[model samples]
Target: MRTLLSNIKVQVNPKIYIKDPETSVLGRKIIQESIILIDEIGFDSFTFKKLGDRIGSNESSVYRYFENKHKLLVYLSSWYWSWMEYRIVFATANIADPSEKLRKAITLVTEKIEDDATTDYIDESVLNRIIIAEFTKTFLTKEVDLENKEGFFLIYKRVVNRIVDIITEISPDFPFPKSFASGIVEGSLHQHFIKDHFKTITDCNDDVSPTDFYLHLATFITKQP
Candidate 1:
């Protein structure tokens, strides 16, 4: 998989950024530091000026890459999902059994993430935390419909549909592939967050991960008549 992942480029929608962050050093720093800063302080508290101070660059420099923090969050979310889709494709590529492939896909989306050393500037693990905590802010707005039309969420939708394809392959007779796939992807994030903070509400804990729960559901869902 390393060979496949080695050549991978995480492409975010062009509408999400004024300039591609991967093209320049300052842009990369803006992305790298913004992830750490947003993770350190919640999105409600994050500001370009504060990020500028953190990176020793003026706020204008940050704006060169993104129009606002919200767009930056979307960009990060897009990149993370694009990266994840890359992993899902490779991880499930050789599996002959539909159930095993479905389980592998479930595990990739639900399990805790670790930093990918190959991507030097982006810490995917940190990005995953941001996605879990702040991703809703990107679309939970009045402008979501317009932005969705502009395809800001295309990468994320593609990730969900990839799982939907696998679900259909396994459960040709099953209904609700889109809803089921989306629930597994987005629901896992909720499970992980609740397990850490709202502990009593979730069965996921130290020994039992969101991955374990979703794997069981994926297996059960595939067997449906």
Candidate 2:
């Protein structure tokens, strides 16, 4: 599975960038180093100038691939979702039970992300940190509606829809599969964030595993009401 995934290229939305970052060595450096820098500092403080300094390139070179940091963020977020969808497909393949499939999906979303060597350029663990820490900024802006119309959120929507399909298969009468899917994904991220930064706000302590909490939520939500 790792070998198969290594050969796969997760495509980002073309509209999010000025040039395809994966096509050039310098462009890929911008992406690889930006993830590291953003994780080290944050999205608000990160800039193409800082990125150029880190990658030993000029600011204009980075700008060639991305118009600005926001577009780069959207590109990174889209890439992460695309990679996650790939993982879900590979992990749940050949599974005959919807309940088991749902469980696997929940675990995949909630569990701690380890570094995936399959993707040599982009570090999955660091990218996961960025997604958890700063991904909402990609769409929470005033331009989100316009971007939505442009299909900027397609990969994320596709991931949620994929899980929703499994959910509806498990409980055909489920009325809020989409809500449940989105909630589980976003909720898992929230719980992790809370656990890391604001422990008082959530019950996600050392004894209470996020995987268990999310699996319980999925079971309860899918049960006949």
lDDT of 1 at 121: 93
Point out where model 1 deviates above 4 Å: none
Q: Model 1: per-residue lDDT, tens digit, 6-95?
A: 787877889899999999999999999999999999899999999999999899999889999899999999989999999999899899
lDDT (0 to 1) per candidate: 0.91, 0.89
> For all candidates, what are the clash counts?
0, 0
Q: Write the per-residue lDDT of candidate 2 for residues 83-179, one digit (tens) a residue.
A: 8998899999989988889999889888889889977788989999999899889889999999999999999998888899999888888888999
Index of the highest-TM-score prediction: 1
Clashing pairs in 1: none
Evaluate residue 73 in candidate 1 and report its C-alpha lDDT on the 0 to 100 scale.
Answer: 91
Candidate 2: minimum summed lDDT over ten consecutive residues — where? 216-225
